[model samples]
Target: MAEQQTWPHHELGRKLNNWGRWGDDDQIGTLNFVTPATRVEAAGLVRTGKSFDLGMPFDKDGPFKAGGFRTNPQHIMTLLPSDTAHTKDGLISADDMIITGLQAATQWDGLAHAGYGGRFYNNVPAAAVNNFLGATRNSFHHAVERLISRGVLLDIARLKGVDRLEDSYEITEADLLAAEERQGVRVRSGDIVLLRTGSYQWFLEGDREHFLGNAPGPCLDTCEWLYEREVAALAIDNHSGEVWPSPIEGVTIPFHQVVIRDMGLTLGEMFNLEELAADCEADGVWEFLFCAPGLKVTGSAGSPITPIALK
Candidate 1:
């Protein structure tokens, strides 16, 4: 049997639990791995001065549609050119506003975003998060400045020689290792690993249904690999960071509960990684200086991010 199938989902969560690993008052989770020295080393990775934006555009046409609990970004023009025309001295300017779900586009799922057994990361009670306050314990605000670090791209789709992996394909720890070997790069401590399944191509092609449906992503057992490697954060080219319609019995999104809640690892979802993957393929360099800081939303469980990779 595969290693991930050996243990129940909840048991895996317990085994990989990182509660109190940092400290009692720790809210940033594994982001603590990105030390000052780590950021300095990551800065040395920029050679060509090329950059890639790995975030999907936040607009009305994003993958998230209406009628769902979370909808796509709705941009409203608060001040249009016509409205600004009334201004004097040609100082007219247009302004706009957006109403969006924090996780509607490319976003970082904070430590409080998922939990099991009425507890969050660091053994914080789920009650700490309330409707009015929203994730008081492991809020996104704590992670705002900690996400910048070295990013390693593990292009699973490219390793498998496919534009995109099949639906519900569960990428395992072995797959990650294989991709690392194939790409000639290694995942190191404090690295913000980006796993590319090429799933975002569907959204770029105007097929939002397929993009949001069952898509390829890391499986439950991969959490162990990430924990062992001390990855600070993880990003994927899918809505959820894990494979959909979860392979585990009686559990949906088991990876989320384990990685986010137990391991205290932040997850970035709906990232656009095609351009970065292509560049990595051409240059044979999979590591880059990654900077994707979350908004200082005081009590938010998640925050939209515009991830950038400098090479």
Candidate 2:
């Protein structure tokens, strides 16, 4: 096997100049300004099993929390109330009631989403940013069109002899390797590593108490290894990539800062990974992966996504 390549400026510049735009972060979120354009290839969406629902429900007329940056909306009306009424009246609602706010569920944080000190994605300094467009000082130049890439699922559940891994268990580098070794799989660079901790199962069951707690997630060492492996992005079945109330001393989910700032890696949290994992196990081929985040417009984050994989 050959050594994996890193996407740092020097190497990335050479690759871009020679091979055109590749890599996950290259997808700029701004495609099809007025009209809808094809964001993903139809062939890439190969559904093998049941579809996963990655959206979180919002409370209707729920009180807004103090100091909350997002203003949650309530869906009180729908286009069609019932098929009988619609057929009799010849009236069909075109829109469904929905509440839009800061999407905390299955979403991708743009490079501009967060940063420590003064660096954004690609390690670009704050001083280099152009704030005239309302973009932050440490913003990442993304438009969403460049996010198309191959995805890989790491099935940690089957390795544990269960339908899903236990919730609140911190996934360690050892755990990751053990799973890989057991499955005879090797993680490649620039692959979107989707980890199935089985937290999503609990989530779908409406177990809010356990879902919000410290769910199974990857440790900092795993983040470091993924960075070293040049993983373009990472998605997990848990809420955040790092387990909540982090065990790392004197730090608050330092892995997030380290991976985002230092490695310029993108994080995908709150994903529905059960079906993806099971499909891979059934096919005996766990490598072909694909993802296309919802086109972000007039919002900080997007709604849930139904990213799929091929055999």
Best by TM-score: 1
Error of 1 at 207 (Å): 0.6
RMSD per model, one decimal: 3.5, 8.7
Candidate 1, 1-311: lDDT as tens digits: 66644447779888988888888999988899999999999999999999999998988888877799898899998987787776677667789899988998999999988987899899999899999888879998989888899999999999999999999899999999999999889999999999999999998999999998998999886988999999999999998889998897778788999999888999999999999999999989999999999688889999999999999
Evaluate residue 25 in candidate 1 and report its C-alpha lDDT on the 0 to 100 scale: 93
Residue-level error in angstroms, candidate 2, position 100: 2.1
Error in Å for residue 250 of model 2: 3.6
Q: After superposition, how far is residue 169 of candidate 1 from its true place, in Å?
A: 0.9
Off by over 4 Å in 1: 1-7
Clashes of 2: 12
TM-score of each: 0.95, 0.68
lDDT for each residue of candidate 2 in 174-271, tens digit (9 for 90 to 100) = 88888888777777654667788888777678675566566777766576467455666777777667666676555566666666555555667767
